[model samples]
Target: MIGFIELIRASGFAADVRQVKLVRHKGDDLDMDQLRNEGWFETYQCFQSKPVFDGCTHIVSVIGEDATASRFVGIYEVQGSTTASPALLPEHCPYTQWGTESRVFYTLKKCPGFEDLEDRVVIDWGKGALAWHQWLTDRTIMEIRPRGRVLAPFRDFLRVHLSFEDLGNLATQPTAHKDWVAALSAVGGIYLIVDSMTGAQYVGSATGSGGIWQRWCDYAKTGHGGNLRLHELCREDIARARHFRFSILETFSRSLARDEAIRIESFFKQKLGTRVFGLNAN
Candidate 1:
């Protein structure tokens, strides 16, 4: 069988190939529930260190507790890399909470997968189906397909609740994802950016001409939406600003007066105690 590494190289990528990883993160509970429900495809995956995965092109994710070749998730096509404090790790990848140092970060695009053909066997590590695996040689191959049930189908649709990690894609990808743009654009309203790093919240109003979508687009582009307080926050740490979760606290008609929205914003700030003890400067 053509091994997984060889298959990728034959597909025309020239970057250094790393061994396919069977990421069975023990004790990490954050992303597991979502992965179990959604079939585990996303734009970002993180590592505790870069040196181990440096100069790599891709990581083939597998799901399991032990290194047994039970199942393969899918391939993550590497784009670019950057590092941030463990605090900046997305809610989906909270496994980094165990790390005492900075974590490796990358933007990974999902490649096609044969979920139907993956994980048909459960080979012992370094023998049989998993024999190709070797420490320090991640490009190692594994069984073409284990014989058994493997995956739940990917949802292939947008969900209503927006996640911080998904917001990054909204900034870069087109609006065809549907729910984010449509729901956010449908009304002008009061929204909140909750800082996951420290639980600081910023109350803001989007009662202007373009509504919440336009306002959020400003935030996605500039990481601050031109708010002086948020501008300062971004200046101090852009990653923190990018990790803020955008949620609508309440919605109002697009025709609502802008002044009324500002009042509502202030009301929310006072009601929520954001300005006195949070990120809001005004």
Candidate 2:
């Protein structure tokens, strides 16, 4: 006989308690109806045999159907036990009466080549409860181990590697002058540029002082003549369009800020063509 612990809750009778059964086996078609009938009958027989103690009211079973299927097991029935009203031990409160409580009961079942079935049973129960019952299962079990050991570190590593790749690509771009301008703008610094009508090409930098917008306005007011590229492109039969707006894509933390800025400038230069500028350059 398997030594199993059944948890009984406080109710009208012992028959009101829920029964959970775990059957670990493979290739056997367990008839649900038969299990129910047999469980209830067994409870009745126990009640009849023991007049002093009332039988169980509920019975729940978790049976393993096939060994091959990933999840060959299932939880069945939260029924009552057959026992007298006002249980013998009133102080022994059940989980149901505690207003949404959970408990773990261990059963020592006798099965061939499966002495460790309890471990599997606990795992199944824990999973069914959506990991709320993890404490009940063995911590060392392979299936229930912490994800930090297997996946978390790898994910972080991947992210760092991808960021480096982005940085490397940025270093080769000439069109990224605008990105540097935007970065400078964020720090209250300015850049001056004359862009193609399409806003695709730019000549800009962060070395100059004062706000970029104000400086650009000053240049326009002084009649420095803007749109050198746009004018040249239009003369070549390229249709000129509106002035391009500069946008900041991202700001890096202080730790990586300098490197990220260089990367962005390089990436833009590579994408937009090499004719970008800074005050230090002629």
User: All models: lDDT?
Assistant: 0.58, 0.29
- Write model 1 residue lDDT over 1-282, tens digit each, in one string: 555545545655344443444343322445442443333334235544554445556655555434443355555666666664656555665344533356666667767544444444222344433332233233344444323333222221232334455565555653334445565677888888887667888889886667777888888778888888778878888676645777778888878987888898899999999889987888
lDDT of 2 by residue, 89-197 (tens): 1243321221211312221222233223322322233334322111111222123222111111111111221111122222233133334324333342212233323
**Candidate 1 wrong stretches, greater than 4 Å:** 1-164
The clash tally of candidate 2 reads 35
Give, for candidate 1, the lowest lDDT window spanning 10 residues. 150-159
Q: Which stretches of candidate 2 lie over 4 Å from their true place?
A: 1-199, 218-228, 231-243, 249-267, 274-282
- Top candidate, metric lDDT: 1
TM-scores, in order shown?
Answer: 0.50, 0.20
